[model samples]
Target: MLQKADQVPAVVAEFIGLELDDAAMARVIEYCSRDYMSSHPHQFDDHVLRQKRESVWQLPPDGTASKAIRFSAKLSLSPALRARLDEVWADTVQKRLGFESYAAFRRSLPNSLGVTRVD
Candidate 1:
């Protein structure tokens, strides 16, 4: 996937008008790998067994190279984890904007929480 990203980085950057620095991009990729990929990684094997509970797949569009790998990325998080994600998102925005208060922050931008106050 990073290799695919390499093919279109400049074109993407041009459209977004945001300079894509290597370090920043790599950090974002690394963070995603830690959170998502670390839990469920692509697994492929031959002579498959019936007990491992792994998904077997054969993808199309294999004109040149063999797409011989696939996996079931099944993940479920509790409600507490979802709320934690909201907190993390708010923290990231607050740090980036240096907002005085959460209510002021919402007023300064678009409000999606639908709450009159954020205190």
Candidate 2:
């Protein structure tokens, strides 16, 4: 969540000695949101639903609120979406890091995938 990122930015700023303003906050949140959504569909939808159902809420840890009240957004894909995403992740790893093994691919997945990470 962006709230968790507030401390991250401050720490990063301290280390790098750079200040992050509202625009930087939004940019980082946006990037993280996309990655988070792509990685966790169940959690993303549940989070949006809970936010919509809340009549009032305490501010998130970072104190910056989401502009969108509800995340009714949907990512429509053909039935091959899962296979495609996996293939892409594998190819990306191969190209980027020279990983070329079934074990390496399996290791990259979340534990929910229930596959052994063996090389």
Best by lDDT: 2
lDDT of 1 by residue, 4-89 (tens): 33334445456689776888766645534433443443332222342222334433322232123234465888999978866886
TM-score of 2: 0.30
Q: What TM-score would each prediction reach against the true structure?
A: 0.24, 0.30
The residue-by-residue lDDT of candidate 2 on 55-104, one tens digit each, is: 35653433323433334566677869967866886788778876665677
Worst 10 residues of 1 by lDDT: 61-70
> Once model 1 is optimally superposed onto the true structure by TM-score, how far is the C-alpha of residue 19 displaced, in angstroms?
20
Clashing pairs in 1: none
Number of the predicted model whose TM-score against the real structure is largest: 2
